[model samples]
Target: MRPRVLMVGSAPEERGGIGTVTTLLLRHGSRHADIRMVVTHREGPAAMRLRLWLSGTARVAAALVRGQVDVVHAHVSERGSVVRKGLLVLLAKAFRVPVVLHCHGAEFADWYRGLPGAVRRGIAWTFRRADLLVVLGSSWRNRYVELLGVLGDRVVAFGNPIELPASVAKPAGLKVVFLGRFGDRKGSAAVLRAVAGLPVELVMAGDGEVAATRALARELGVPAEIRDWLSFEERDELLASAHVFVLPSRDEGLPMALLEAMGHGLVPVVSPVGSIGDVVQDGENGLLVPPADAAAIRQALASLLADDGMRARLAKAARSTVEPFAIESYLDELAARWRSLTG
Candidate 1:
């Protein structure tokens, strides 16, 4: 029988990568294994909030008690760990089944980055107890080891998977997109600054604390398109017409936007953070610039605008780079890893 995995994470309205990853896992996971998605928070239409909670947590937990679940994957950190995720982990421990902790935040390091004394020791202890700890890149393996040294052997670096678009998007040179939340870490402000004075039109496709992003665009006099939210179809249309994809996040855990843009064949100009090394390969697949450096971003953008060949080559590579992130490959590797761990 296929192993039954109970995957848990935020709902769709949260606008985070974990949600995307979880959705992709379930959509593909069914092919190889029995999967139940336990969404732990509210998203989308307000009226359905209560319904999702009962169906997701209550109905799912009852199934677990009846021996329906074999593995429970917690898609959040241990501290901010919600009730649904925490309960599932405790249950897995009691049942003597394996549990997977997938950490996607840049804050994973911050949890014990430079700590001292007994508290740091406690944090290390919790990490040690994790059956399997998953992270974005091998570069961070040692850092995780520093804190969870005892579980070092159990931890693995698995790059986040993304869906490839049906075909490479044809750039009209009339549009550009920045598809993450507005904030210092995301550095949407920097993307705005980099595109300043350029003839190309721009759209900002998320919402956050920065009312100033709009003001900043106005001050710099760039024609701005701002949307509070976008449907999946609308987002695809934006990606289709966009000439370039720029993610100026100061820190990232392999931003799905960057990967999806690559899937859609939009060249990326991104900061080298998390597992981005797998996605952006400098002048080869896409552009890479120092995060928070508007000048570097501008220069990369200018180069792409001037050279059609460079843009086309990078776009082609971007689409191909995401071939590994397809739904099928993710499910195959995940099932193999689960069997390996449990065997």
Candidate 2:
């Protein structure tokens, strides 16, 4: 019989990369192993979300008591996610099941630094006790080790994976695409300011602060095409029509949008945070800008717009860079790793 793995994270219906990764794992992993998901988080108001978590926690505890699970793979983010997963990790320990703590938050290091010393120590203790600690990149791996004193051997840096898009012809206009939350942390305001009055068509896709973003665009007199909450097909259509893709996030754990854009052969102009620098070589596959710098973003955008040859070369290289992150290869490796851990 295949080893039964208990995967803990957000609900399948939840948005963002964490949910995307979770859904992909459960889908592909079922072919190779017995994988069950216990959602400890969901999308709703505070009280509703809390109730779901409490109910989910009870279900997980019941599963442990049944003695059917061989491994507990917990996907964790920062702040409240960390606290919730910390409890799940302890619960898995009590049941004597091997645990994998997968850290996906890009702002975790900064968040950890801001916590009280006691809370920091507690977090470190929780991390150290896990059988395996999975990070999204080498940068994050180094931070976790330094912050938690985790053994180097215990941590693994695995990049996120995606299905590549079919080769599409480049569109006519110099279109720029931004697909993510329109929030301060995502640096949407800076993108608005930078792309303002530029001779490029900027397509801002996704939810959060939509009204604010529209207001900013009006204030700047920048006629950006803002699409709130696009479907997968809609997002792909926008990417296909783009010569450049820009996401100037303050933090990220290897953004799926950037990877998807690169896969669609859109040249990237993103902030160098999280695992982005590891994937995007400056002046090679993509251009990197400092976070929250509207002027710098403008300069980069202007440069890309001015140079057609540079954009074409970078676009070719950008697509090649993400080949290793293909979903099939990732799932094969993930399954093998799980087997080794469970055995």
Candidate 3:
């Protein structure tokens, strides 16, 4: 029999990494497990957000009482996400359900370290109690073990999966794409500065500080095409038509945009922060730049823009790098994890 798993996280309709991951799991994971979604967070006023959390928690409690849930898989980020999902972990433990805490925060370590000692201990207690903690890479796994005192055996690394495109037509001209939030953490301003006089045309899309991003682009005279968050089809179309993808983030947790862009055979010029170094080998499959360094970003972008042979070689290699991260392989591995917990 399939294990009954409650996949908890933000509303799948939201546009972000966790929402995208959760949506993928629900759409594809049903064949391997009886997966049910429990949205613990969403974008809205404070009252609406609180109501969603309360109702989601009530559903979980009810399911536990009725013996309907076999496992609780909670996707968590920093700050409020940690506190919210930590409570779910404790509740699941009280009901004797195996819990899998998936950490997706790009700056989780930084945020955790800045907390008061008592608050840190409370968070640590929540992590240590979980049956397993899922992280994006080996580095994150090591960090959890060393910093949070989570048992090494309890942590597992799983890269975010993507649907590898069968073929992507070579796009013409020097067009570059950037898909992520527009904020300091994502280095949106730095991206504008880097591309300011470059020969490449830039397309920037995503939520958060959109007005500020537009203002910065104008101030820099970048002439970049800045847009709001895109739908899946729009994103894919943009990826297919772009020659290069750049994300100079200060931190990341294996961004889905990076993987998807690479899968579409767009050469990546990204920062070597978070789990990006694990996926992108500098000068091999992609180019790595220092976070928040516009000069370095410009240098990397200039190198790729000037050399077609190098760009073609790197784009082909970039697609190859993400082939193993196809959704089928990820789903198979996740199914195995669920079985082990329920067995």
Candidate 4:
């Protein structure tokens, strides 16, 4: 029988990168493993989340009592997420089910280091108890080792994966796209400062500080297409037509947006945060800029706008870079790891 896996994280219905990642993993991972999921958290009022925590713990305990779960895959961030999932990890250990802690938070290093020494040590103890820790990129793997003092062998990095479209024909017009929350963390404000007067049409998709972001664009007298949210088809159409994908996030954990953009063959102009620098090499697969730098962002966008040949070269290379991260390969690797852990 296939090993029974329980994935604990944000509800798939939640509207954020973590939700998107969980949805993709379940969709693609089911083909290779017997995976089940429970919601430890969801997007809503704080009161709702509190109820979920109580109910989620009950459900996990029930599953453990029935011996239906062989592995527990807990996705976690810092602060409350860490504390909650740390309890789940200890619970899973008590039940003799191996736990896989998938670290997805972008600001984890800063958050952990800022904690009081006692709290930091407590967090580290929880981390050290996990059977395996999955990170989005090698940089994060190093961070976990250095921060928690966990063995390097137990922490592994796997890029987020997605099912690829058969083909993406270049669409007409110069379209620049940004697919993420609209705030400083995503560097939406910086992107606005950079492309305020650019010739290309800037399409900002995703919600957060919508009113403020729109006001800034108007204040700068730049025409932009700001959509609160895009359906899957709309997102696909936008990426296919886009010539450049920009994300100058102050922090990120291998953003799904950048990977998706690269898969769609849009040359990425991104910050060197998280594991982004692992895939996007300046002047190679894509361009990398310092986080939250408007001038640098402007220069990168300007260069891509003026040189069609350069864009095409980077686009081709960017598309190739995502091949290894294809959903099938990701599933294979995950299944292999699960098998080893269970055996």
Candidate 5:
């Protein structure tokens, strides 16, 4: 019999990596396991967020009481997410259900360190209670075990999944696309600064500090086309037409946007932070630059724009690199993990 897995996280409509992951798992994971999602958070005012958390808590408690759950898999980030998902983990443990805590916060270590010592201990205790902890890559697994005192064996490295595109033809023009939140953390302003006076069309899309990004672009005299959050079809359309994908983030946890861009055969110019270094080999599949460094970003982008053959070679290699991260394979592995715990 298939084990019933209760997957809890942000709402699918929410914009960000966690929302994207939740939507994909719900859409494609049913074949491998009987999974249902409970949204404990969304993007909105504080009062609305509190109501959703309360309601989600009630639903999880009721499911536990009725013996409807075999496992509770909670997706968590830093700050408030740690507190919200920790409650669900404790509740699941009280009901004797195995719990899987999937950590996706890019700035989790820095955030945890800034907390008061007593609060940090409480958070560590909550994390140690989980039967399993899932992270984006091996480095993250090591950090969790060393920093949070989670058992090394209990943490698993699972990369984010993407649907590999079919035979994407190389784009001919010098068009650059950046898909991520537009803020200092994502280095949106730096992208504009780097591409200023360059002979390329720049398209930047995503939420957060959009107005500030636009202002910076105008100040730098960069003719950038800034858009709001995009739907799946819209995002793919942009990727299909773009020759290069750039994300110069200061921090990340194996960004879904980077993988999807590479899967679509776009040569990437990204920063070597978090698990990105594990996936992108500098000068091989893609080019890696230091975060927030406009000079390096410009140099990389200029080189890609100047040489057609190099771009094509890198684009082909980039697509091949991300093939193993397909959603189908990810679901199969996830199902096996759930089965192991239930058995």
Candidate 6:
């Protein structure tokens, strides 16, 4: 019989990592078994498949009465979602379902890094009951084990899953792409500053920071082109035609855009933050520089543009490196883990 599963979250219904991962698991869970979702807000393409609205805790109690819910995958972000997530985890346990906590923030540790011992203990205690805690990087694992006192066995290092194209990258013009929200943490302004006076076209996608990025571009006298958030198909077109994908983020959780670019064989130049080290591999798949360092970012872009063969080689290697972290494997691993928990 297929195991019933519940994925709870704040914007669990949104079209981001939390939604995407939950969707992937549900899709693959059926291959070996069966699973369902319980989302606060049903978001993303997968919602169309097994869409659920947040019936809240009342639903968890209601579902338990109906039958066994094998597992609860709680996806949490840093900004005030923890209270809701923690409450749900407690509820899942009461419902007799095993719990897996997957964090979406890159600076998970840093958020509590400077807190006092009592405060940190108080915070860590909230998640101590999880059967499993999923972090994308080894560093994050270490942080949870060492600082948070989560057992080593409970932590799993998983990367952001991307669906890579089988085709190799074709030669394209000097296209520099920045795909993310136009926000301060993303350093959209820095991207504009770096590309100013440079003889290259920039494709800036997403909202929020568009006005600021464009303003910076105009003030710096750079030829920056702004586009709305690209759809999956449009993103493919852009990555396929682009020469470089640059994400100068002050924060990240292995940005999906970076992996998607590598899937299409575009070299990445990003800040050395989050699980970026899990994929960037510096000088290997892509180049990593200090956060907010526009001068260094610009230099790296110039260096890659000057050497097409080098960029192509890295992109090829990147594509290969990311194959194991593909969506199919991600689903399989997650489903297997969920089954193991239920059993």
| Local distance difference test scores for all models | 0.75, 0.87, 0.91, 0.89, 0.91, 0.76
Clashing pairs in 2: none
- As a TM-score, model 6 comes out at 0.89
Off by over 4 Å in 2: none
The C-alpha TM-scores of every prediction are 0.88, 0.95, 0.97, 0.97, 0.98, 0.89
Regions of model 4 farther than 4 Å from truth: none
Task: lDDT winner between 4 and 5, please give it.
Answer: 5
Which pairs clash (backbone N, Cα, C closer than 3 Å) in model 4?
A: none
lDDT of 1 by residue, 1-343 (tens): 5788877777644666887788788767787788877776655565676567556667556766788777777787434443345555665676677788787776666655556767667656555656887787776666677756756688787778776777754746646788988878888888888888887778888768457788888888878887765666787888888878888776677777887778888888888886787567898999888887889988988898899999899989888888887877877887887776567
**RMSD per prediction, one decimal?**
3.3, 1.6, 1.1, 1.1, 1.0, 3.9
Q: Global lDDT for candidate 3?
A: 0.91
For residues 125-159, write the lDDT of model 6, one tens digit per residue.
86888899988778778777897788899999887
Candidate 6: clashing residue pairs, number: 5
The TM-score obtained by model 5 is 0.98
Provide the clashing-pair count of each candidate structure.
Answer: 0, 0, 0, 0, 0, 5
Model 1, CA-based lDDT: 0.75
Please give the lDDT score at residue 58 for candidate 2: 92
C-alpha RMSD in Å of predicted model 3 compared with the true structure: 1.1
The Cα error of candidate 6 at residue 148, in Å, is 1.8
